[model samples]
Target: MNPNMTPNLMAVLPTLIIMVTGMVVLIGDSCLKGWKSTKSLSAIVTLIGIAAAGFFALSRITEDSIIVFGGAVVIDSFSNGTALILLATAAFATLLAMTYLENKNLNLGEYYALVLFSTSGSMLMASANDLIVLFIAIEILSVALYVLAGFARTDEKSEESALKYFLLGAFAAGFLLYGIALIYGGTAGAAGNGGTTNLTLISEFLRHTNGVANPMLMAGIALLLVGLGFKAGLVPFHMWTPDVYEGAPTSVTAYMAAGAKIGAFAAIVRVFNAFIPISPYWLIALQVLAVLTMFGGNLLAIVQENVKRMLAYSSIAHAGYLLVGVCAMAGNPRAHDTALGAILFYLFGYMLVTMGSFGILIWLSKRGHDCTTMNDLKGLAKTDPTAAYTMLIFMLSLAGIPLTVGFFGKLQIFNASLMAGQVGIAISMAVASIISVYYYLKVVWTMCFQEPDGNTVEGRATSSFGVNVTVGLSAIGCVLFGILPQTLQFLINASNSIMRP
Candidate 1:
């Protein structure tokens, strides 16, 4: 290796690979004429690219952190681990989409390409060391997702979802960019560095200056939080979540719920942890947001009959749980390991369960029918025992039942919060979780105990080997992680070294 070469290349190698792969896929699709050839080839390429990226990310397991691109990006344990998770998520989602699109005759070559491109953006967001780069990455990811959400443009609901998401996402991006400009202004005037938007420089400036509490800096931080909060789907800014989830294609919804949340949490953790000296002022804001998000999300989920809508609310509630981890880090920067570890564990568990649950939706959406309502699952056990069983495991895991990955995830989060003296937030989380069980179990009951409606009873049932494998793997992961919780703890500890605090 060249002694002058920076290790940051190794950190962002996955994102760079995926970005190149996306362009190749796009070109191939444009040249390839037939649906079967384009779909199969594109899917293969996408999976291979994601796997390659993940492998590259996993290979960099050293203890040191490296900043790349003139300090515009950072490679550390935290980002590398998150990049692996994001790539895996994109790969599995592509697999699910391949089968789903084939069944629905919706396999466009651009779909896989867009997913890879968006995932690359999310990876960049996770690793970004500069505010401008972070904002750009967020827009790249958001734009792709907006298009994907409205992929079924023929459907009015899909079109509506896309429009709403686009408008609100654009609005959020504006706030974020403006916030970056303001923060740049504050730091620039004080440091004579022409408004340095670099996070490390900003941190140094805050440390050396008496203007840490400058009104402009506070305003910028608030705007930045609002922008990120919208993406994370926290309360008071989560209005778009339910409608979008209910309207988007099921596979896309799963990708957004799992992969997007991981990216957002990673950004949140980085922004707060890296700027900890001035974070105390915002800790109170996060505390209040966490409590409200937990209670409000669970309460909304209780009344939703549409399974997708309910899951949307549940996603918000999960954001609240993650926020507790964020709050813990703010209050006790020394406990970075515990806080970040819990967040990652929770994200890992959440991805498995959510993907498994949405896999059932994709599998059931055969012959142009979208089976999204709770009633549609009635008599699922009788018609398709394997899918029902898989969904059951997912439901139980999401409900945080014992011997499931979700249980261990919650345990770690609660432990972290307790250690950080956020007992009230933890207690609220527990209660909300109890309330959530009712709706999650209601699906299980509908699947196992209720009689099938005439339409579903007469409808054909089909299962693809690909869907079966995905669901089976996810269910096994939930059970295995639950049984071997220490494995996750170790991974979390290893990843913690990259966190800024």
Candidate 2:
């Protein structure tokens, strides 16, 4: 089939593939007999579907951007880069969930199906070029995740987390939709034609018409921050993160951490990047939020006795770092590609660490018990030295210690900040990094030096090909990228490509 003859289909090929696969999975779960009854079948199907979609996305990386469906969704390098990250995260999460579900005896086929469905939504969000399209994509992802948050039907905390996520998420969605309405009203009045939600059209209106001076348009952008910032787990809007993370299954926690950030921030980058004339206004707000998020998240994490909650806070801090890169490009839309690329690279590294760390946490959990508190890790090095070593690496990476992906990722982001002459924020990052050390290292030191409390109960760490590979690869990736000088250049180039359209 000629691509030009069916541009809409071609542009949404991956999304369709993922959507169709989710339907197939739902069908399989409902109709399959004994042999297909195991949830593994569903997980396998989801993995295959996500893999196919990811391959399709990669193949289109060299193709020119195509805005289909009346310019609602645009396939471009920026979307592809973000889509690849979401796909990788889904793969790892699927693998983690397979074992997690089986062990907990909570292997509902709907779990994997929901993940695939949510992932497809994230993909759409990344490619969305219109406000209406973006809002729909956000709801698609959020609705599925709201259910998944409490997938463990018997757990009270799971139910609470799911409820909290849904309510807060709905509130955020209202803000986003209202922002879109305001923007549409402003544009319609200024452009003389009926209102439009398309980003490209909106940018044009701002540049070529009186839409720039429209108070409602600027107010709409501010409202957009409230909505997207909440989604990205920024401060004041971040209250839900720790509770939800600690309440949800570790596997789901891992998936949501990176996936949500990827989608929300992609929208943030696109908006700020395209609306260059409005940069000075939003940039100051983003910078202040970034600083608060950095210091606030790090400080809160420092006092957490629970590792899961600590990671929840850590996620917030990482979002702040990503925001810093955005602020670095505040005065220079030309730096959009480079700044976004740096954020993407850091996200990749962060994903690796989170997957491995939570994988270990999953392994430490036995049926009817969640392994999380810092005390539970005491004497882990004595019991399982290999696992201990892996944890050490992840901790070091999280702390931004040298010779790990996390280190280089921080270096690039900080370098971008300095280039933008945002020294105060850079210094805040440095201080936050130092303050973060005590907690990260505390985990390492506890694992290596503390003795097992006589009364402390522990689960036997299990081994399987899937778990081993996930953990090993993430740890290796952290170190491999750290020392590999060529990888950094490759990331820069890949990031540069995102703006080709």
Candidate 3:
């Protein structure tokens, strides 16, 4: 609507490339209905598109922040950095899905298309400057995920996962929309223009007035947290995580774990950054949520026998740790840069670790069945040393073992929390990490020490080359970034510059 055509178009180039790629894949797949290589071709196309998008996003790292499309969207260091992470996530998911779909007899061209579409949505979420844009971005992400969850159409569990996610996801969207409406009403007179849903405008209004005293604004913020918290898989709203992660296909689970969290947390950080002025009213609520999510997720994961479900709970715990970084952003303007950089770095590291862990399951899966239980991994070290070692790396990283990216990421967050003077939260996070170590080590112990049962496949060879690549790349990322955190200095710089008031 705003006639800043060139800048606005350039601002959205990466997302545009992704959406176009999805359409191209869809059309190509439809036109090549009888070709045997259609599935592979779709994957190849999707990967190239993601790579191109990443290139464009990387090119924007040094550009000045630009609010485009009448402030509905923005292109900034934060968005550029987030886009790269999302693209990396989509690339890895595509690589894993290549062999995974073939093994499950679910190799459809639509799978890659949906992944591209969903990733485009995630990219938009990271840059969204308006509440309406954020909601649209979320739906674009959620709808594709619902379909991907049920891609294994014949699996009853897959269908149930899809149904539950869709129902719960719709309710979450409702909460988010209602929250936006209330904020719009509460701020109706603040800007002297009826109302505003633009984040920048909201900040401008709040800076001049007392947002905490406005009951409607406070209520809106609470509901908004509920909606975003549900998406981030925080405790009290994390009921769907274990069931959905267990029931979905392994490749889908990996993507859902990484991509969804990246997008949701990016939005959470950005939205809450806008609310920093009135943080006294909401910071306590977030702190409580962080502690609850950290302990609840770890304590529950300790009892899980199913590997996928355990990882699901582990993902929730990691969200709590990320929330600790979010808490650091409040009441301490000086700590904002450290906290934001830590959160971004942590998300990238977690993406690599989580996807690589699940990639092992995809690698071991037999045709038409997923290797899901802890017992399925028993004696894996003897049969597939490569996968076992790779899994070991992911487990150690998840447990925050030294020389892994997870440890450094956690360390940064720990320091950031302390910088904010949240000694209690810092201690709680340390205890939670200790609690998580047991379950992660349990995974490694089962893989290396336990005897193979009758259900364990004998002499299993790596089934998919794509999965091998995914696991290998993820392992390298985990260690490479860990040993040399400076490798991510560009992303850290981006995080440091974001959300400045």
Candidate 4:
């Protein structure tokens, strides 16, 4: 085989496996229609596929980074580790969905298929080395999510959420494509052969030329940031996040919150790493956006009466924290590796915490009705002590309390910011974290101290083996990683070692 034509297939084995598994599930669902065991079988197959993909991804974490498919994709520790996070998230979401789907009369095989396909796209985004591949990967993920958002077609909010996400998502894609076009035109020499859409080549070109001075290249970079920042749920472009997150099913929201953010930030780090040599020109914009996102998300979350909306805003704030790591990556060359490692660590911790928090909501949801309002949690301790305590840990972690994974995740980012000499950003993060505590603890107090009204989810908590397992595992992981933050340090370190072509 031609070296460029075949390259190393092992590098992308995980992504291939995920994509194939999605097809199998989709087909199997259609063939097994009306079978009593079809629903359980779908969930089982989804878990097995995710486990296989995660195994491949974890193994790749220690392998040397290599570019494949003519440099359009790169198999590096960064991509591999991110792939693992995305896969693990999918697995957790699958587990949560098992009973939730059955409760909502949505135990369809297509649901599992969409989850698998979306996960594959997230993996591809992490590995994308070329602009074209990045765009395709994003679309693959977004299209599936748009459908998944409206999976509860009978519900008007679900349908509305899907429509809104699709519209905004389409516009974001346009911005990304336009940015790529401008970048390509700006880089192309008068002879028409020097321009490239490959990130590595773009970096080399910019390093050699005064790329920042070129109007087209500068505009493209700005637009590119706008496009991706929207996906990452940064401030000003985050109007869609709350509505969409609240309207989607709790199970989908859990997956979307973690899986989408991981993919977006992975792409952000890769794209910006290529632009790091010109960090001075772009760092200010990112810093401003980070400050806005943190404050905007936190302040807005404080007054939310609906639990889903509150958590939705919370997700936005977490994105701000992740952006701090991105800023640290660009602000100081010396802090690059540390910042990248911090980001991956933060993503892992946040995924566990977010999934667990949302899992609680799913557990409390009654048949055909979501238990997402603040009222539903009143006096949970008196009725369901196991659930109440699990939620307490989740709330504490989100507040960044001592000895929780959330606290350590923020600490690493804070330290990285200080290392990068971003004192203002560091302080901003601290203040924002403090502000977040009020809302998170309010949740804890509602469950533990308050009296339940006539109507509360605790009075009618749903029991599901799958949801219990998901929440239990998430809480344990949160506490474990918090006490032994160093346990995953080596993996984070390896994951940040992105290779340049």
Candidates in order, TM-scores: namely 0.95, 0.95, 0.97, 0.97
Q: For candidate 1, give the lDDT of residue 156.
A: 91
Model 4 spans > 4 angstroms off: 1-7, 32-39, 190-194, 499-501
Candidate 1 lDDT (Cα, 0 to 1): 0.83
Candidate 2 lDDT over residue span 350-414, tens digit each: 88899989888887777777788888889888877887889999999998999988998898888
Instruction: Give per-residue CA lDDT, model 4, range 1-501, as digits (tens).
Output: 666555467679999989988998888888755644544888888888889988888877888889888889999898989998899899989999988888888888899999999999989999999989999999999999999999998999999999999999999999999998888887786324867889988888777765354778878888999889888889989999999999898899999999999999999999988887677778999999999999999999999999999999999999999999999997555577788888999999999999999999988898967999989899998988888899999889988998899989999899989999999999999999999999999998999899988778754355688888889899999999999999997667765577331
Q: Each candidate: what lDDT?
A: 0.83, 0.82, 0.90, 0.88
Cα lDDT, model 1, residue 263:
87
Using TM-score as the measure, the top candidate is: 3
Candidate closest to the true structure, highest lDDT? 3
The CA root-mean-square deviation of candidate 4, after full C-alpha superposition on the true structure, stands at 1.8
Q: What is the per-residue lDDT of model 1 for residues 118-173, given as tens digits with 9 covering 90 to 100?
A: 89888988888899999988988899999999988788998999999999999999
Question: What's the candidate order when arranged by decreasing lDDT?
Answer: 3, 4, 1, 2
Off by over 4 Å in 3: 1-3, 33-39, 459-462
lDDT of 2 at 341: 70
Q: What is the per-residue lDDT of model 3 for residues 1-501, given as tens digits with 9 covering 90 to 100?
A: 656587779789999999999999899888865544544988998999999999999998878898998999988999999999999999999999987787778888899999999999988989998989998999999999999998899999999999999999999999999999988887777667788889998887777775454888888888999988988999989999999999999999999999999999999988888888778889999999999999999999999999999999999999999999999998476678899999999999999999899998888888755788887888888877878888999999999999999999999999999989999999999999999999999989998998878777453444577887888899999999999999998988888657646
Minimum summed lDDT over a 10-residue window in model 4 is located at 492-501
RMSD (Cα, Å) of candidate 3?
1.5
Per-residue lDDT value at 417 in model 4 = 95
